[model samples]
Target: MSDADDAGHRRAGRPLETVLTRPRITAAALRLIGATGYESFTMSGLARSLGVAPSALYNHAASKQVVLQWLQDHVMTMVDVAGFGAEPWDTALRRWAWSYRDIFATHVPLISIMAVLPVTGAPQTLRMYETVAAGLASARVPTAQIVPSIVALESFIFGSAFDVAAPADIFETGALAESSPIFSAAVRQGEQIQGKARADVAFEFGLEALVDRIGRLRRP
Candidate 1:
């Protein structure tokens, strides 16, 4: 065929769509984890789920951990930090903490991965830290205390998020109820509190205490 005919034939064909990219890979990895737990996660498995060869994934990601890093960065982008600029530090932190907790409560698998992962190449994660740091500084918290404060807050948030995922009967004393009367009675009382999930109620209780303690840092 002549060059003109060949060019027309190419134009008549449907446009090819991009099959692999950082976003696509991140999404696929999250779905795989949600469906089969991270224990079953693998680069080959992800590639199969994405309808591509295992080698094709390497063009975008170096390893499974790299994809997980991408997922971590993407997840951080979901946290709400909007109150940081406009609200008092306490208010802003409450908003951010609730958002952060809610996300990881459902993403328990990622909590450990993110806790130990460095922020070197994670832009969204870095942005989150920057916002919180600036908010703390704005509230007159000492620069030296900012990092430590962040670490402490994150530790609580991670623990709270994990708690949110525990079985509903986690607090149940079972056959040992008679041995732990006071604790069992309180658990029963907590179950009677209306309108909120027990985990949420507990999280709010801790969040309030944390906010109070952190706010005190700004005072003499």
Candidate 2:
């Protein structure tokens, strides 16, 4: 073909080539989810968001589950696991727990889905796990306990992420305060605490306890 013909052909194929990458697809999927929410998210909606046909999206991601896996992996990259090897195990665990909670605080919609998502094909997710597991092992945690320890930390982190997004008055007793004086008093005391947000305070409390408990799991 002539140079001009070759240029035309390349130009014709540019739309799909430019927009159909895994990154692009994942980005579009996130945008769609953010706009319409996970419940409303669909492959057709994702395709429309990217200005492509559903078939094109399907060509890259075989199913919605595949796209979700892509998103899970992409989000996992944001979690801070660097401290695992560089810092003491407890310090690394604290840093990772805080970072995980903060990152997922804005991504609460994905929490339920990711809880069940397997790490089999997700490299970034697997890498995060490997780093954490290795860190715990290096701390001398028993081999059989590593996975359970990680799961325990994750359960706390995920729950705290949801808590981070909760309303400031979520626990406000309001009209029920009179009948629930003790609980209401504690809530008032919590509100009176200075500096850190209530969520941060609660998370710190829980994380410190977990870190201390897990640290004890270290083998002699």
lDDT of each: 0.86, 0.86
* lDDT digits (tens) for residues 97-163 of candidate 2: 9999998897887787789878887788899999999999999999899999999999999999999
Off by over 4 Å in 1: 1-19, 31-40, 193-195
> Candidates' TM-scores?
0.83, 0.85
Total clashing pairs for each candidate: 0, 0
Q: What TM-score does model 2 achieve against the real structure?
A: 0.85
lDDT of 1 by residue, 120-192 (tens): 9788999999999999999988888889888888888999999888998999999999999999999998788
